[model samples]
Target: MAARLRRRLALVALVRVFKPGTPGVGRRLAAVPRLIAATLRGQYDGAARLATMAVAAIYLVSPFDFIGVAIFLIVGVLGDAALVTWLAGALMDETERFLEWERGSGRRPVA
Candidate 1:
Protein backbone atom coordinates (compact mmCIF):
# COMPACT_ATOMS: atom_id res chain seq x y z
CA MET A 1 0.00 0.00 0.00
CA ALA A 2 2.83 2.40 0.80
CA ALA A 3 4.55 1.61 -2.50
CA ARG A 4 1.35 2.24 -4.46
CA LEU A 5 0.78 5.52 -2.64
CA ARG A 6 4.34 6.66 -3.35
CA ARG A 7 3.96 5.73 -7.03
CA ARG A 8 0.72 7.62 -7.33
CA LEU A 9 2.18 10.65 -5.57
CA ALA A 10 5.16 10.60 -7.87
CA LEU A 11 2.92 10.40 -10.92
CA VAL A 12 0.91 13.36 -9.68
CA ALA A 13 4.09 15.34 -9.06
CA LEU A 14 5.33 14.52 -12.56
CA VAL A 15 2.10 15.72 -14.07
CA ARG A 16 2.26 18.96 -12.08
CA VAL A 17 5.79 19.60 -13.28
CA PHE A 18 4.55 19.45 -16.89
CA LYS A 19 1.42 21.52 -16.29
CA PRO A 20 0.47 24.36 -18.68
CA GLY A 21 1.67 27.38 -16.65
CA THR A 22 5.15 25.90 -16.23
CA PRO A 23 7.98 27.87 -17.88
CA GLY A 24 8.75 25.67 -20.85
CA VAL A 25 5.07 25.12 -21.66
CA GLY A 26 4.33 28.79 -22.33
CA ARG A 27 5.75 28.66 -25.85
CA ARG A 28 3.69 25.63 -26.81
CA LEU A 29 0.48 27.14 -25.39
CA ALA A 30 1.17 30.34 -27.29
CA ALA A 31 2.01 28.49 -30.50
CA VAL A 32 -1.32 26.68 -30.58
CA PRO A 33 -3.33 29.87 -31.15
CA ARG A 34 -0.78 31.23 -33.58
CA LEU A 35 -0.93 28.05 -35.63
CA ILE A 36 -4.71 28.08 -35.58
CA ALA A 37 -4.90 31.71 -36.68
CA ALA A 38 -2.35 31.12 -39.41
CA THR A 39 -4.26 28.18 -40.73
CA LEU A 40 -7.58 30.07 -40.69
CA ARG A 41 -6.03 33.12 -42.37
CA GLY A 42 -4.35 30.98 -45.03
CA GLN A 43 -0.93 32.19 -43.92
CA TYR A 44 0.58 28.70 -44.02
CA ASP A 45 1.07 28.74 -47.76
CA GLY A 46 3.06 25.59 -48.35
CA ALA A 47 2.66 21.88 -48.92
CA ALA A 48 2.59 20.93 -45.26
CA ARG A 49 -0.53 22.89 -44.31
CA LEU A 50 -2.27 21.69 -47.45
CA ALA A 51 -1.42 18.11 -46.66
CA THR A 52 -2.60 18.45 -43.08
CA MET A 53 -5.90 20.06 -44.05
CA ALA A 54 -6.48 17.56 -46.85
CA VAL A 55 -6.06 14.65 -44.50
CA ALA A 56 -8.27 16.32 -41.91
CA ALA A 57 -11.02 17.01 -44.43
CA ILE A 58 -10.87 13.46 -45.70
CA TYR A 59 -11.18 12.08 -42.19
CA LEU A 60 -14.09 14.41 -41.54
CA VAL A 61 -15.97 13.34 -44.64
CA SER A 62 -15.17 9.63 -44.42
CA PRO A 63 -15.01 7.44 -41.33
CA PHE A 64 -12.31 4.86 -42.20
CA ASP A 65 -9.03 6.76 -42.67
CA PHE A 66 -7.17 6.10 -39.44
CA ILE A 67 -4.21 8.34 -40.21
CA GLY A 68 -6.50 11.03 -41.47
CA VAL A 69 -8.52 10.74 -38.31
CA ALA A 70 -5.45 11.40 -36.19
CA ILE A 71 -4.47 14.39 -38.27
CA PHE A 72 -8.01 15.67 -38.14
CA LEU A 73 -8.06 15.40 -34.38
CA ILE A 74 -5.02 17.68 -34.07
CA VAL A 75 -6.25 20.19 -36.64
CA GLY A 76 -9.75 20.13 -35.25
CA VAL A 77 -8.46 21.18 -31.85
CA LEU A 78 -6.66 24.15 -33.37
CA GLY A 79 -9.66 25.04 -35.50
CA ASP A 80 -11.92 24.94 -32.48
CA ALA A 81 -9.59 27.20 -30.55
CA ALA A 82 -9.46 29.65 -33.45
CA LEU A 83 -13.22 29.63 -33.72
CA VAL A 84 -13.57 30.33 -30.03
CA THR A 85 -11.13 33.21 -30.24
CA TRP A 86 -12.96 34.65 -33.21
CA LEU A 87 -16.31 34.41 -31.48
CA ALA A 88 -14.93 35.96 -28.30
CA GLY A 89 -13.55 38.88 -30.23
CA ALA A 90 -16.92 39.47 -31.86
CA LEU A 91 -18.68 39.24 -28.53
CA MET A 92 -16.31 41.77 -27.02
CA ASP A 93 -16.97 44.14 -29.89
CA GLU A 94 -20.71 43.88 -29.38
CA THR A 95 -20.38 44.36 -25.64
CA GLU A 96 -18.31 47.47 -26.18
CA ARG A 97 -20.98 48.92 -28.46
CA PHE A 98 -23.66 48.19 -25.90
CA LEU A 99 -21.63 49.79 -23.15
CA GLU A 100 -21.03 52.83 -25.29
CA TRP A 101 -24.73 53.18 -25.96
CA GLU A 102 -25.55 52.89 -22.27
CA ARG A 103 -22.96 55.52 -21.39
CA GLY A 104 -24.27 57.90 -24.02
CA SER A 105 -27.82 57.60 -22.74
CA GLY A 106 -26.80 58.98 -19.29
CA ARG A 107 -29.68 57.00 -17.74
CA ARG A 108 -27.80 54.10 -16.12
CA PRO A 109 -25.49 54.45 -13.13
CA VAL A 110 -21.88 53.90 -14.05
CA ALA A 111 -20.22 50.99 -12.28
Candidate 2:
Protein backbone atom coordinates (compact mmCIF):
# COMPACT_ATOMS: atom_id res chain seq x y z
CA MET A 1 0.00 0.00 0.00
CA ALA A 2 2.77 2.43 0.91
CA ALA A 3 4.65 1.56 -2.25
CA ARG A 4 1.54 2.23 -4.33
CA LEU A 5 1.07 5.61 -2.62
CA ARG A 6 4.69 6.57 -3.28
CA ARG A 7 4.40 5.60 -6.92
CA ARG A 8 1.26 7.69 -7.31
CA LEU A 9 2.97 10.69 -5.73
CA ALA A 10 6.02 10.28 -7.96
CA LEU A 11 3.82 10.06 -11.03
CA VAL A 12 1.98 13.23 -10.03
CA ALA A 13 5.25 15.10 -9.55
CA LEU A 14 6.54 13.95 -12.90
CA VAL A 15 3.34 14.98 -14.65
CA ARG A 16 3.38 18.40 -13.01
CA VAL A 17 6.94 18.94 -14.17
CA PHE A 18 6.47 17.72 -17.73
CA LYS A 19 2.90 18.91 -18.34
CA PRO A 20 2.77 22.45 -17.04
CA GLY A 21 -0.81 23.17 -18.08
CA THR A 22 -2.32 19.92 -16.94
CA PRO A 23 -5.47 19.75 -14.87
CA GLY A 24 -3.40 19.46 -11.73
CA VAL A 25 -1.76 22.83 -12.36
CA GLY A 26 -5.14 24.38 -13.03
CA ARG A 27 -6.54 22.91 -9.84
CA ARG A 28 -3.61 24.13 -7.72
CA LEU A 29 -3.66 27.58 -9.31
CA ALA A 30 -7.41 27.76 -8.82
CA ALA A 31 -6.87 26.90 -5.19
CA VAL A 32 -4.96 30.17 -4.69
CA PRO A 33 -7.96 32.32 -5.57
CA ARG A 34 -10.21 30.15 -3.48
CA LEU A 35 -7.74 30.45 -0.62
CA ILE A 36 -7.63 34.24 -0.82
CA ALA A 37 -11.39 34.48 -1.17
CA ALA A 38 -11.85 32.24 1.81
CA THR A 39 -9.40 34.34 3.78
CA LEU A 40 -11.26 37.49 2.88
CA ARG A 41 -14.60 35.96 3.74
CA GLY A 42 -13.36 34.56 7.07
CA GLN A 43 -14.21 31.05 5.90
CA TYR A 44 -10.76 29.47 5.84
CA ASP A 45 -10.86 25.67 5.70
CA GLY A 46 -8.42 22.95 6.58
CA ALA A 47 -6.96 22.62 3.09
CA ALA A 48 -6.33 26.31 2.59
CA ARG A 49 -4.87 26.68 6.06
CA LEU A 50 -2.76 23.65 5.44
CA ALA A 51 -1.29 25.37 2.39
CA THR A 52 -0.28 28.32 4.55
CA MET A 53 1.08 25.99 7.20
CA ALA A 54 3.21 24.25 4.59
CA VAL A 55 4.74 27.58 3.63
CA ALA A 56 5.45 28.28 7.25
CA ALA A 57 7.05 24.89 7.63
CA ILE A 58 9.33 25.59 4.70
CA TYR A 59 10.39 28.80 6.36
CA LEU A 60 11.06 26.96 9.59
CA VAL A 61 13.17 24.34 7.85
CA SER A 62 15.27 26.91 6.08
CA PRO A 63 18.78 27.65 7.38
CA PHE A 64 17.78 30.02 10.13
CA ASP A 65 17.16 30.15 13.83
CA PHE A 66 13.97 28.32 14.71
CA ILE A 67 12.37 31.01 16.84
CA GLY A 68 13.36 33.80 14.53
CA VAL A 69 12.31 31.76 11.51
CA ALA A 70 8.85 31.23 12.96
CA ILE A 71 8.44 34.89 13.84
CA PHE A 72 9.59 35.88 10.38
CA LEU A 73 7.24 33.41 8.79
CA ILE A 74 4.26 34.77 10.70
CA VAL A 75 5.12 38.34 9.83
CA GLY A 76 5.86 37.47 6.24
CA VAL A 77 2.56 35.69 5.70
CA LEU A 78 0.55 38.48 7.28
CA GLY A 79 2.39 41.17 5.35
CA ASP A 80 2.22 39.36 2.06
CA ALA A 81 -1.50 38.65 2.35
CA ALA A 82 -2.24 42.22 3.39
CA LEU A 83 -0.16 43.58 0.55
CA VAL A 84 -1.96 41.45 -2.00
CA THR A 85 -5.35 42.42 -0.62
CA TRP A 86 -4.46 46.09 -0.65
CA LEU A 87 -3.07 45.91 -4.17
CA ALA A 88 -6.24 44.23 -5.43
CA GLY A 89 -8.34 46.94 -3.81
CA ALA A 90 -6.16 49.60 -5.37
CA LEU A 91 -6.49 48.00 -8.79
CA MET A 92 -10.28 47.93 -8.50
CA ASP A 93 -10.31 51.58 -7.43
CA GLU A 94 -8.13 52.56 -10.36
CA THR A 95 -10.31 50.65 -12.81
CA GLU A 96 -13.46 52.30 -11.44
CA ARG A 97 -11.84 55.74 -11.72
CA PHE A 98 -10.84 55.06 -15.32
CA LEU A 99 -14.36 53.96 -16.21
CA GLU A 100 -15.82 57.05 -14.57
CA TRP A 101 -13.43 59.26 -16.49
CA GLU A 102 -14.29 57.52 -19.73
CA ARG A 103 -17.98 58.07 -19.10
CA GLY A 104 -17.41 61.73 -18.29
CA SER A 105 -15.42 62.24 -21.52
CA GLY A 106 -18.35 60.78 -23.50
CA ARG A 107 -15.90 59.52 -26.13
CA ARG A 108 -17.13 55.92 -26.27
CA PRO A 109 -20.70 54.86 -26.93
CA VAL A 110 -22.37 52.72 -24.26
CA ALA A 111 -23.00 49.21 -25.50
Highest lDDT among the candidates is held by which one? 2
Which stretches of candidate 1 lie above 4 Å from their native place? 1-71, 109-111
Count of clashing residue pairs in every prediction: 0, 0
Candidate 2 vs. true structure, TM-score: 0.35
Residues 1-111, candidate 2: write the lDDT tens digits.
Answer: 111111123223334434644334333443444445544665432344345445644654566535653679887657556544443333333223333333454534233
lDDT of 1 by residue, 4-111 (tens): 111123224334435664323333334444344444665322235335444645554565544544679877667655544443333333223333333454535222
Instruction: Give the TM-score (vs. native) of candidate 1.
Output: 0.33
Each prediction's TM-score versus the true structure: 0.33, 0.35
What lDDT does model 2 reach?
0.41
